[model samples]
Target: MQNASKITEERINKGSLLALAPIGVFLVLFMGSGIITGDFYKMPALIAFMVAAGVALMINPKESLQNKIDIFCKSAGDPNILIMVIIFLLAGAFGSVAKAMGAVDSTVNLSLSILPANLLVTGLFLVVCFISISMGTSVGTVSALTPIGIGISQKTGIPLELLVAIIVGGAMVGDNLSMISDTTIAAANTQGCELKDKVKMNFFVVLPAAIISIIIVAIMTSGYQSASTETYSYEIIKVIPYLAVLVGALAGANVFVLLAGGVLFAGAVGLFTNSIDLWGFIGAVSEGMAGMQELCILVMIVGGVIGLIKHNGGIDFVLNYITSKIKSATGAKIGIALLSSIIDLCTANNTITIITAGPLAKEIGEEYDLDPRKIASILDIFASCWQGMIPYGAQILTAVGIAGVSSVAVIKYLHYPIFLLIFGIISITVDFSALKKKKTH
Candidate 1:
């Protein structure tokens, strides 16, 4: 029994680069095929992930096929993965019912009536940031705001993909800094730091990125004219559902409860306004869930594939390699950031990435006499940086799914994530800690 336990531990730490090949295969099939055909839609992400899952199953021939299949299935059915699936379905239902009842159009027209065309994108970025911070969930923010973004795009002719990208970027800002965010909680607890300290540390690093992003978005929309020259009209009643959802989120309601309430309330409004009858409301709910089927399946496949890669030691390999290179304090910070970023790239979930990398980051911080607050900040910031920009991540996927745009098109306009990465690197290279101490003295 002892020998078997030891062997299992050895296999877990037996880092293998070959374990990562399945992801490469997926990228090749998905992006490579798209590049060759000059159209990304030529290759579906679902088909690409399916092929990758097959590759994952083939990697560990020494393990029994049944065991491998069990691992894959276990990952696909993980609690976190299942929760995301549920969120997707509920968000879809809410967005669909709201739109069917004219909530999106009413909200968009109301926004247009208030903000100038040149400031629309900038205003949206700010609004999403505020809501995301209050809600403490980037995916939730994206889910709630994406329909309005789509409506704005159609009315203003401001490139749907770009607007979606802006919404994703703003959502990430809150995800990184929100005190109630899972990533923030995981990172702070794992590093043995106070949540408020971590939030403060993160605020300094992320503030510049957020400010610059606002300026860039403002400039990007400065010369734009609304495609429609006519005045917009709105019904205050149709906007109630969105307002209620936003208020619930800000009040710290559970996400599941908030979404379910949104769906029911939207349906009620639809019925009351005669925008949709009872049968139509039911149909809208079903159609909305159906639209999310592709995204849900892709998420499960990605989870299973990541499970295989981790079981085969792909994540352990990367972890071992990065930790081995740490020679100084700065190197340790970079290692923590890189570890969080790469793991997030594989997992497509920032909260999971932080949980996975946090213990080792704590160890590295102790070894180098580094501040736990900074370590926690690094874990949250870098994870969010990748999570915001990655094409396969939930935030980007949710936005694209709602906006009906390709991930590649949306990625090009994701300025906040890129700026966040830049500011994060700068935070490490320059010692803000010293400056703070100097000012205090």
Candidate 2:
């Protein structure tokens, strides 16, 4: 009996620090080369992911070469990666077709017609927040708004990266607060709380942060009030595609279907305006798919490489270390946040990060008599904040892909996520008033 117990206790967790080498290799090769060249985007993101994936494959030397290949292929074929690729394709098609139909310009000029130039950033941020809240998907929000942001930047001569960052911040607001968001679902489910309760609790905490962000944007863009020398000759009819797409998305239409519908709507408008014919519309779609090729490739490679890291217990090792350090209620909350943050850093997918960290967070919360609502809120908020800030995270990557810039450029202008993260830490550490209502069993 003693010998058998010893054998059971000796079980090894596959986790190793060396499993992290691929990611380190990627950042060095990608960012180091960029710094040396003084142009961050000169080395394509796809190339970086490619080399990193190669390193990931080589790291598992104990596995047969064929077995390692199987793991990569399976990870590449993961449902999440496949779904994102589909969305990328549809988003590209819709963006290109709608732009060709003049929808993007029409939408930008239409906003300018109604809102003051200084309020453009504020207006867009609120728009994305509302839309994302309704749709419950940050990537969808970014894809829909990034073109408009790019268009507004073109017309207003603002930095394109700044606009992309602004849109991403807005998207994070919705992702963090939305009742139906995947992060919200994972957190609520794992913490044994009602989703509605989680939403109510989170709103109290994050609303002040939202207000702060809007104020910052207003102040930052105030100078633009005196600089508006541009005029728009936008056609109202041409704006229908953007309007339809926005309305469809807000109504909770399936994202892929929503984007496809927008493309067909744009094509019809294009045909009427002589902007495009059958061949031209088809060419636009092909061109759009071509545009997404690089981003799609990067997503698949990342999914596979990260999957290998997960399989090798790299993520588990980190999770264990973070959980091992908790000693108090505040420490538990902070640990939960840090746990989510670290998992998001490794996964690059906020929803998956929440799922991975939520169970551990729940146990920590229970141990400390922490409120379930607060735990859920921390998980979602930190995940969204981390996802929005990380350069390689899906939210920022999608925005960067659309805006055609390095993620570093956009990270500097992210007002909402930075303020949200600060407020999240403050709410837990300094003021638990927002969470004062006891977690009623």
Candidate 3:
């Protein structure tokens, strides 16, 4: 819940263009170079981030080198940053433990059992959507659902790419809206909005888009029957942990507690069912923690990098530039949304995009008297949609790589993000609320 470090009045008034160079270096090294190399992951993310951090140190020579390093470290250790990292660990642990103990399979099979074979595609989309919504991370959702989706693909003669696209679409729902999602967290924190408030405002626009996408999936796959293998038995007990996650998130429980409870509950279920021994549970938990290593590193380093940028006035410069053209509430919202989309496209990581865009969007919103809750929704929506669209973005790349297809093959079918973008446009254009009129008058 820690806010960003405050800037002095003089510093804000005298924002330097040089402060923005560190971010530029980061984007060029990570995104521009990837486009040129034709391999998005070719550059090690951590190394590129470190180099950008170094650039901030070099450019801001006012402080001694050691002092600069200290500033970077402090920012990396910010309470908000630490909390985000902790959530990553817990979420990863829950995901690993649940899958190892058959929770994912149980949930998937139970879903498949209820619906007819011909509705497999739409059902699968909904199942993945629910799982991602519960799990609160699209990457985890992709990893968990892709294999099952592949199996269904193989059996039903459904195109693997199509299923991957549907999963990708479903994954975006949680990435943009989940209570614990990094995107949601970043937006809510920076905009000074409650998590529940953001969710409440976001759903008005997001659910309509989700409903439209679901209907489209059903229509597109109307005659397609998944093979007879769709019918599989699942233990009722195994599904309880997943239900706990969904229920806990929706009930407005603290994310940290929800995930911690989920891990313990899932482990207990595994123990009582004799699916895992004591050591095995500990090992599953450790493995899950291990899986979070890459994400943790990226987050910590990015925190440091962003800290240096802000300390040197880079963020102030960006705020000035991005807000300069906004003259109305609608224009301000458009700027906020476009800023997130553009940054996310460059970063290829929606959470990181939101982290970078959130503070700036918050400033713009406050300046224009825009609702912070709606700004939070705009940041999540635009960032997620743009991340979903880019063929080379990590989400698409990861999904296609796992499905053994081209990113382009699945990019076209990511209808959720596209529709979300459309709804977002409509919501911003038509201010149906009396408060909007009151604010203007």
Candidate 4:
């Protein structure tokens, strides 16, 4: 009887593993080959999903092929997945339209010209950090700041990719810790903690990392020389669209609404200034939407695959396995961190990873007498760390695409992000000894 039970358990585990095969396929067929071929975008992410998802159907023994296909379709058609698809569309359209209208170049030049050469890198990093912390979206921060980052690199003789890395690192720090950040919302909701409390605990840990990063960038850019450039004039009215987007987003507007507002605002400015005719503006918006359709599709497919995997008990299997091995409080904390990080890797979306990992980590926290605050911090920190460094993740991929460098090349100069991870791990492992002592006194 015991032997039979063991066999059943093994079969169940195998089934769970099969449900997660899409992620593996995505990594191997898309990211793996991309790395091998030295082109991250070479393999369309959707093709990878199609191939791996097909394999998932084959791995299931209980379901008919048609049933498996239906399951995949259902998972892919979820509302959250669809929402992300829409966001990607708007983001792409906005970015493309904004660029084509010369907003990017003009903004970049204006920023570089205004800031002192010596403080260029540090100033840009600080600006991005503030924007993301206030706005709670790294992608938004990057979109708002990359043009300027690119310009600063050109004018200051700094390595363009490295400059971009600095901005990415700073923006990620805010995304992980900001009170209004989606990742924070997910973590707080999952753990049943108040947002302010999570931010309070998280701020202490991340502030050190932020300060260190700024100091390092400042030191690196101390001897920079400013290069002169041809003067380009842009209507200040054109700048209002970016400012409006930032203000609206920071004020808690829906992303779709914010982007819509940006589109209208920018279009009006362009039309008034004769930068584009009405039909031309409409065409720009259409082109923008078309540019992002690929990314939007990939989001839908990934979401559906993940939903099916979750519904089929893949996440539960991993969580059960990790929780089973928790022999002590310290072990439990480490396990939670690792589990959150792994989920972040699989999803390449910090907010989603935090939501998935939060409840389980909270349970571990209760069992270990660990502070919910600390658990929340760990979830945010490690997720952001992985999100920033992972080559296939959106942040690094965007940076890689914009800087014209391989993801691997940019990863090397990500000094602040790597150090932030190290500092986080050390603080956790050492029981935050220094902070603990300071509190005691």
lDDT of 4 by residue, 197-277 (tens): 666666666767778888887788788866755464655666666667666655667667777777777787777877888
TM-score of each: 0.64, 0.63, 0.88, 0.69
Candidate with maximal TM-score:
3
Which pairs clash in model 3? none
Q: Assess candidate 2 and give its lDDT.
A: 0.73
Give the lDDT of residue 8 in candidate 4.
Answer: 35
- Alpha-carbon runs more than 4 Å astray in model 2: 1-14, 116-207, 216-231, 326-417, 424-441
How much lDDT does each candidate structure score?
0.77, 0.73, 0.79, 0.68
- Can you list the residue pairs that collide in candidate 2? none
Query: Which consecutive 10 residues in model 2 have the weakest lDDT in total?
Result: 1-10
Query: Model 1 RMSD to the real structure?
Result: 8.1
Hey, what RMSD does candidate 3 come out at? 4.4
Deviation (Å) of 70 in candidate 1: 1.5
**What is candidate 4's TM-score against the reference?**
0.69
Candidate 1 TM-score, true structure as reference: 0.64
Residue 165 CA displacement from its true place in model 1, Å = 9.0
lDDT of 2 by residue, 1-441 (tens): 123223223323535777767767866765677568755456665687788888888886888877877888898887756766776677678767776677656655565566666687788788778656644568877887898788778777778888898899988877777644556655776677766667766786678888988888888776654255657567888877766765665466766677788789889999999878899899888887798787677667777877777677665554444445554578778888887887676556676566556656765675567788888889998888888898877788889988899899889999888888888888787654444566354
Per model, how many backbone clashes are there? 0, 0, 0, 2
